[model samples]
Target chain A: MEQTSGTQRLVLVVEDNPLTLDAVVAALDEEGYRVRRAVDGMDAIGEMQQEVPDLVIADIHMPRMSGGELVRRLREWNVPVILLSADTNWSRTAGVVFVPKPFDLDHLLDVAANLLDEG
Target chain B: MGIVELLGVRSAAIVPLNVAGNRRGVVIASSAQHDFFTEEDLRFLQAVARWVGALAHRAELVQQLTAEAAERGRRLAADELVTVLAHDLGNYLAPIKARIDLLRRRARREDRQRDLQDAEAASQALDRLRRLIADLLDVGRLDQGIFAISPQAVDLSGLARETAAAFQAGSNAVRIGGESPVPALADPDRLRQALENLLSNAVRHSPEGAPVHLDVGLEGNGDGRWAVLTVSDQGPGVPPDLLPRVFNRYVRGSGSSGLGLGLYLASRIAAAHGGSLTVDSPPGQGARFRLAVPSGDELSGFRGEAP
Candidate 1:
C-alpha cells in the first residue's frame, strides 16, 4: 500500500504479521511519507533489490531471515534503519537505530522523522 | 615408590583405586620395619582398598552427573529467557501497540467515536497482557509455594465461550462445542487464563485457516463426576520427543513463539484446582489438550444453581 508520499520518503515496514504491517504502514502514510510492506527480512531484501527504501523499520525475529540480519546487510546499502523487538541483547549497529516492541506510535513516527530529518 | 624408598620402607603394599571402572591411581602404606604388618593387617587393607575404589568410582560418576544436570538447566534457562521474553511478550505487546497506534491515527483524522468502536478490542488485548504479567508473578509465588486461587462455582461452558471469544477475533477460527452448562468448582479468572493459554497455543500452531476447537463437557467414573474442557487444533501435532515434558516450564517446541509459560502455568492452575491438564498428540494429527476439574453440584454449596 502506498501512503501519502507528500514528503516522498519511502519507508519500508517489514514484519511477519499482516495486521502489524498494515498498522505501521498506515501511520507512516498519515505522516506524509510513502510506505512499503514486507513480511520478513527476506521479503524486505527483495524489496530493496527492486528499489532501495529511504528508511527501514523491521522486527528482529521472523521466518527465513530476521531484521537483525537485514540491518547488518543494510549497512552496506546506506539505508537508515530502525530495528524493533521484545529482545534484550542484540546490539544496534553504528548509524543504525532501534525501537523496542510495543513501541509508542508517536515515538516511532518521531524517530523516523528525525532519522529522515522530516521536520 | 620413590617416596617410600626415600623413607627407607622395608615393607610396603600398593592398592589401585578404580575410578569409574578405570584405574586412576594407587595408595601405598609403608613402614620402616619388615614386621610392620601382620597377615590380617594386609587382608584388612585389601578389603578397605576395595571399598575406597568403589567410593572413588561413585564420586566420579556423581561429579559427571551434576555437571550434566547443570548444563541442561543452563541451556533451558537461556532458551526460555531469550525466546519466551521476546516471542511471547512480542505476541501481545507488538500487536497491541500496533493496533492501538493505528486507532490513534484514525481517531485524529476521523471522528473520535470511530476509534472508540475498537476500544473493546484494545481493552481485551490489554487484559491479555495483564493476564500474562499476572501469570508470571504467580509463577514467582509458586516458587515460594504460596500461590493461591479463589474458587467459585463456575459454569465451565460459559467460561469457555467468554475465554474463547477474547482470542477468536483476528481469525475467528475457534470452534466451541459440547455440553453448554458444564459446572465446576474453580477459580474463574485463573481457569479462564488456563483456557486462554490452551486456545492461544492451539491458534499459534494451527496453520492459517485451520480451526481451533474447544469442547466443554463432563466425565465420570469412581472418582465422581468432573467437568472437562478440551482444546484441539488442526496444526502440526506436538513433536514426539516433547510430548512428555510439553507442560514443563521453558519447554517449547522448535520455532514456537510465546512465553513458554502457557502450558506450565495452565498445568499448575489445574493442579491448584485439584484438577489435571493433559495432552494427546498422534503423529501427523493435531494436538488435543484436556483440562478437568471436580464438578459443582446442588449439594456442594455452589454459588450458581445446579444445572
Candidate 2:
C-alpha cells in the first residue's frame, strides 16, 4: 500500500522469524513507506527481482542464504542496505548501514528515511 | 675381559648394575688368588652397587619432579594474569551493559526510536565485549585445571554438521562432509565451543564466496580411536614459520584481528577431553585445523571433572 502523507518509497525487510518480520513491516508501514517482506536472503533476492526496493534491511544469520550473502549480491545494485546482526565485527561496506539486533524501530526508520533522502 | 685377566685376578665378585628397574651392566671386582674373594666381599660389592643404583634413580626422579613443578608454576602465573585481566574488563563491561539496557528501555517508552536504536547498538557491542571477557576467563579456568567437562555419548558428526551450518554466510561457504553417528565421549557444550572457534577462524580467513570445509569421522589406530573434526578454509594459508605457534595465546596471523585466544582455548578444551588440536597449512593452499577427541570406548576411566 502506498503512503498517503509522503512520497511512496519501497523497502524490503528480510528476516527469518515471522514475528520480527511482521513487526518491522508494520513499523515501516506506519512511517509511510511501501514495505515488502521476505523470510530470508534467497526469498529477498527473488522479491528484489520482481521490484527493487529503495532500501533493504536484513538479518546476518539465516537458513539457505545469509544476510551477508544478500548484501554481497545486492552490492551491484548500489541500493542502500541496512544489516542487522548480533556480531559486532561485521565489516563495513559502502552504501550499507548496520543496525544491530534488539534495535529501536524508530532509529531504523530514521536511517531508512535518511538513505532515501540522500538518493 | 682382557682388563680382568691383565689384573691377574683368579677370583671375582660380580654384581648386576640396576637403576630404576632397568639393568645396565655388571660391576666386577677381582682378586689375585683363587677363592680370594670371600662371601663378605661379594656382599660388600652388592651393597655398593645397590647404593649407587638407588642414588642414581633418586636423582633422575628429582630432576623430573623439578621440571614438572616448574611447568606448573608457569601455568599458574599465566592463569593468574588472565584472571586479573578478565576481572577488570568484566567490571567495566557490566555497568556499560546495564546503562545501555536502561537507556534503550527509556528510549522505547518515550517513542525515541533513534535513541533506542543507538542504545541497542551499544548494547550489542557490550554483549560482544562480555563474551570476549568470558572466553578469557574460561582460558584462565582451563589453565588452572578448573574447567569442567561432563562427558557423555554424543553423535559427533551431527554436531559438527550443525556447527558448520551455523557459520554459513554469504561471503564464506561452509560445507560439512562426514558419516553420521560418529559416536564420541565428550562434554557436548565444550566440544561445540571448540568447533565454533575453528569454524569462525576459517570463515574469517576465507575470501568472499570461498568455501570452508569441515570433515568429520573416526581416526587413529587399534590402540585408540578419535572422533576427528577438521575445518579447512580456501584463503591465504598461514606462513610456515607461524604454523607451529598458531594455537599459542595472543598469537594471531598477519592481517587478523582479536586477542588470538580462540585457538588457544579451543586447544585447551580438546586436551581437557583427552583430545588434540593440530593445524596444517602448505603456503598458498589455505590452512586446515583438526580436532580429535576420544570416542566413547576410548574414554574409559577418563575423568574430566573440574578441580
Candidate 3:
C-alpha cells in the first residue's frame, strides 16, 4: 500500500538468514512495496536513519544490535516494527508482532501484507 | 605357550624385541585348565613382539581417525554458520560495491550497462541473504529441540507428489519416478521437510536443465521391512572419500550453498521415526539419498494411502 501520510512505503528488513530474507523481500516486492535489508540491528538502524522505511522486520539475535533495541529505536521514531524472531522470549515484548521460526510462508506474507496495508 | 594354554586362558601377552616400539607382540600360550604362563615362554614371545606391536599401532591409528572424523562433524555445525555469514555477506557486499562504483563513473555508455548489471546482481545477493537466514533459523530451532512434529499415518506417495509440486512451482524442474504403495507412520510435516531438503540438494547440484529423479517404494532388509524414499541427482556425484561424511552437519561439497544442516536434520527426522537416511554415490554416477522407515504389523496402524 502507498504511504498515506508521507513518501512511498519502504520496508527495512533486518535478518541474518539469507533464505528467509529473500522470501520476505520477494513477498514484499510481489506486494508492490520498496524493500531494503540489513544483516544486523546496527545496520538496520542506520538504514532507518537514512531511508525511514515505513515498516521494519527485524530478527531478534543480530550481531551488533538486538531486535529489541531496533524496535525501541523505531518506537521512539513512531515507525511500525514487526519482530520476526526464533527466540520465544520475544513474546514478552508488548505491542511488537512476533513470528516464530519455521513459520508458514503464506502466513508470513499475509501478516506482512496486512501490516503494511494498515500502515 | 601352546594352543592348549591359549584356549584355556583366553588371554594375550605383549613382548618387546628387535627395534624399540617396532617388534613388540605377545606369544600367547594358554591351556584349557587356565594355568599360569611360564618364564621359558617369554623368550619366544620377545622375538615376535615387533610384528604384533606394528599391528596394534595400525589399529590404534584407525581408532584415532574415527575419533577425529566424529569430532569434525560435531565442530562443523558452528563453523558452517560463521563461514556462511561471513563469506556470503562478502558476496552480497561485492555487488553493492560494484553498483556504487558504477554510479561514481557517471554517464558513460559502458558505465550505464555496469550500473544496470550491478543493480541486478545486488538484488540477487539480497535473495541469497534471505535463504541463508532461513537456514540459520532452522538450525537454531533444531538445536533447541523446538521444532514440533505432528505424527500421523501419511500416504507416502501422496506426500511425495505434493512436495514435488510445491517445489516445481518454483524455478527448478524435477523428475519423479517409481509410484508404488509406500505408507508408513511418520510426521507428515517432518517427512516433507526431509524430502524437500533432499530434493533441494539434488536440484542445486544438478545442471540447470537436468532432471532430478525421486523414487518411492517399500522394501525389506535382511532383518525387517521398510518404506524407502530416494532422491537422485544427475550432477557430479559426491567423492568416494566424502560419502560417509555427507550426512554430517557442517559438511558441504563443492558449489554447495547451504548451512549444511539440511541433511543432518533429515537424518534426525528419519531416526526419530525409527528409520535411517543413507547416501549412495559410488564415483562417476549420480548421488542418491535413501530415507528408510521400518515397517511391521506393529506399524500397520501408521500406514496410510499408497503411491
* TM-score of the A-chain for all models: 0.87, 0.89, 0.84
Q: Rank the candidate models, highest TM-score first.
A: 2, 1, 3
Candidate 2 residue-wise lDDT, A10-119, digit = tens = 88998775656776776676567788898888898899999988888887666798555777898867788888654333525555888755455556767878888786
TM-score of 3: 0.45
Model 1 clash pairs are: none
Whichever of 1 and 3 has more DockQ, that candidate is 1
Stretches of candidate 3 off by over 4 Å are: A1-119, B1-131, B137-150, B169-172, B295-307
Ranking by DockQ: 1, 3, 2
- DockQ-best of 1 and 2: 1
DockQ of the candidate models in sequence: 0.35, 0.02, 0.10
- Residue ranges of candidate 1 with Cα displaced over 4 Å: A1-119, B1-132, B298-307
Judging by DockQ against the true structure, name the best candidate.
1
Tens digits of per-residue lDDT for model 2 on B1-307? Answer: 6976888878988999899889977889878999888789989999999999999899999999999999889877876666445534533443355456556766887899899899988876776666576787786677576566777877788788777776664578788888666778888878998998898888888988888899989887876899899999988988888888888999998767778988998998899898899999988889999999888644444324211
CAPRI verdict (incorrect, acceptable, medium, high) for model 1: acceptable
lDDT of the structure predicted as candidate 1: 0.78
What value does the lDDT take at residue B124 in candidate 3?
Answer: 53
lDDT by residue (B152-237, candidate 3, tens digit) is: 66667778888999668545577777744566667876798789888988888888778888888878779787778899988888
Which ranges of candidate 2 are over 4 A from the true structure?
A1-119, B1-37, B44-92, B102-113, B138-149, B161-177, B209-211, B218-224, B280-285, B297-307
Give the worst 10-residue stretch by lDDT in candidate 1 chain B: B298-307
